[model samples]
Target: MSLLKVRDLSIHFQSRQGILEAVRGISFDLERGQTLGVVGESGCGKSITNLAIMGLLSDNGQVHASEVTFEGLDLLKLREKQWQKIRGKEMAMIFQDPMSALNPSFTVGYQLEETLKIHEPQLTKVDREVRCLELLKQVGIPAPESRLSSYAHELSGGMSQRVMIAMAIACKPKLLIADEPTTALDVTIQDQILRLLKELQDAYNMAMIFVTHDLGVVAKVSDNIQVMYAGEIVESAPTRELIERPQHPYTRGLLRSLPGAKETAFRAPLTSIPGIVPALNARPLGCQFHPRCDFASEKCQHQPILTELRDEASTHLLRCHHPQEEVL
Candidate 1:
């Protein structure tokens, strides 16, 4: 059974510009010990989806979800006090930027200890301190005893990220939403972090939603992948299935644009879909991707419902009138 299930979730921000729909009716599931990668370009609502799931989006943002059930409990309907109990103990989030996420004034140890205290206030100071040091070591920080005493500024980018991960998993959450967890890290560091998370997930059997713009990263970590575009999922399939046989034009374009693809080198300067994403205040009348899609037809301008594309595979779904030439 799925540990976390999200169905038709929509998160909108009512701003001075207008009501911007950041996440528009997206859905996915995460099973125990599996990583579900939410992949998309910038401003495609990947982070917003994570925020909605974590219940961290601002008050200005309105969330509408058909259902957000974590372990069969309706997360959307939870009271603030109830959510507080569940937040650290059952679900935790590793945010995008560690520099901005961590407090400069407090030592990493204090923050991590506080995280545990919030959930299990019964812990003694010595116990919390010991637990904090242990968590730091588990995240692969060198000399974690000393590192815990160091402030956020005292750590390198990769080290700070590990601290953030330690803080997140302090209470051993059942599900971890890691948003661009290794975005600014070097390639080697990224691999290290990903491997660490994978190891921890296996050890704890924790489900994860790993969000990133890099398909390469998703290729390495994800058990399943959901491709988002213009606030909606354009394509979703098992990780290997999506990579080996992409069906949607957008998915195919993304695959083709990979740096090492031989066909990409032969294509016209590496084709990129033209036109900016449609304004959320005034979203296109039909398929959201139609504006940038080369295979758009008159039917595409008539609001095609996202539905099953392949009869053989129940898991793969897409929203496109004329899906690109199947590169399966």
Candidate 2:
């Protein structure tokens, strides 16, 4: 059975104007010990989708889902108190900004100790501290014992991010939702963090939802890839298949835009899909990506539902009125 099953999930924000649909009935699954990369440009609802799954959306945000099942339970129906028990125990989240997520006043050790207190309250103080140090060490932090006493501001960006990862994995949660965890780190540090995550995933046998805007990052970490646009999944496929033969125009554009090591002068200019993502308050009716999709047809104005684009058992799915052959 899939570790997580998200089906027909919709999220809307109640505003003065009206409802702003942020996620429009998207569906996907994450099997045990697999990483599902949710990729998109900024404001494309990648983060929101993870947040919704984690039940971390703002108070004004309302989720309407047929089901968000994790371990045979419907997460969407869980009460706040009920979900709290599951949040850091059965599942955990790694926010994008570790600095913001970690308390400015508390030491890293204290923050992690607090998480332990909440989830594993039965553990004695000494046991909790020992576990915290072990977690820090597992994440490759040197002098883990001393690092615990350091404040959030005292640690470098990379160290703080590692600490955050440690805290998320402290409970050995079966599922981890990482929201652009490496977005703010330098390229070198980013690789280290990605490697650390993969290591942890393997060691813990955990399933993960990796939310990222970088296709390169997606390629590095994902088992399966879901390319979202505006507020819906535009395409999905096994990682290699998606990268080699993207079925949606948006997905193709994302791959083409990735920076390469080729000679800059001879390389084609990175192509971007034109037009801003539609405002949530005034999202496009038919195809959310139509205004920017080069292959959009009149039929797109009627909203192209997601469908398998070919006769073969491609596994890849796309939402497009006019699909194109793979670009060389």
Candidate 3:
């Protein structure tokens, strides 16, 4: 069985303007030791989808699903208490901003130990300290013992992120959700973090859900990729397949927008999608991407169901009235 199964999951938030659907019905399965990358522009619901799965959505947020099973347990049916037992121990998340995620008042060691205390209560203080050092070392923090006494503010952005990664994996979770974990770092630092995550995932044999806006970054780490738009998945396929043969217009636009996508000379202009993503409350009817799609037609006024391409066994899926045949 898949390690994680989500069927027709939707998320809505209560607001003064009325309920806003942040995530429309979306379904996907994840197997053990596999990496699934969710990519899209900001506010495309990539983060919100994973937040709902982690049971971390706000009280005003409502999650409905036909099925959300994790390790054979029904996630939608789990209570806060039940989730607390499974959350950090079984699965953990690395937030976009590590500085904000870490508490300023506490030393790094205290925070790391607190996680161990909550999740691995059987460990004695000495064991917890040893594990904490090991975690910091594992994440490549220099002088793990000394860094332990430093506060969040004392660490650099890269170091802070490393600390976050350490805490998230301290319990040796079976699944890891990295929600733009490298976004706040420099390009070099981002590359380092990505390599670190890949190594850790391999070492621990953990399934991962990596959420990011950078298709290039996702291409490096994901076994499969899901491109979301306007709270819905527009395309999904094996990483290489989707990268080389993107069918959805939005996916093509994203790829074309990447720097050096066209392999032009230095200082050449980059391609960009025409318009901004629509507000949730003001989203257009039918296909949400039609407004920005260059190839949109009258038929695009109606939403397209996600359909498989090539054959019944093909893994490439697309939700488009005019799926592209030519490779971008």
Residue 144 in model 2: shift from native, Å? 0.9
lDDT comparing candidate 1 with the true structure: 0.86
Clashing pairs in 3: none
Model 2 scores a TM of: 0.95
lDDT of 2 by residue, 1-328 (tens): 7889988889888889898888897988889899999998788888888888888888998998888999888897889999899998899999888888889998999999988999998999999999999999999999998998999989988999999999999999999999999998999999999999999999999999999888889899999999998889999989998887777888887777667825435656877668787888888779988888888778889988888766756578888877767553
CA lDDT, every prediction?
Answer: 0.86, 0.88, 0.93
Q: What is the lDDT of residue 99 in candidate 1?
A: 77
Better structure of 1 and 3 per lDDT: 3
Candidates in descending TM-score order: 3, 2, 1
**Among these predicted structures, which one has the highest lDDT?**
3
Can you give the lDDT of residue 299 in candidate 1? 88
TM-score, each model? 0.95, 0.95, 0.96
Q: Model 1, poorest ten-residue lDDT window?
A: 262-271
Give the least accurate 10-residue stretch of model 2, judged by summed lDDT. Answer: 258-267
Better of 1 and 2 by lDDT: 2
| Residue 252 miss distance in model 3 (angstroms) | 0.7
lDDT per residue, candidate 1, 1-328, as tens digits? Answer: 6899889999989999888888888887888888899999888999888888878788999999999999999999988899899997899988768877899999988898889889999999999988998898899999988987899888888898999889888888999999999998999999999999999999899989999999999999998899998899989888988898887888887887666775544445765667777767778878888778888888887876678765645588878777654563
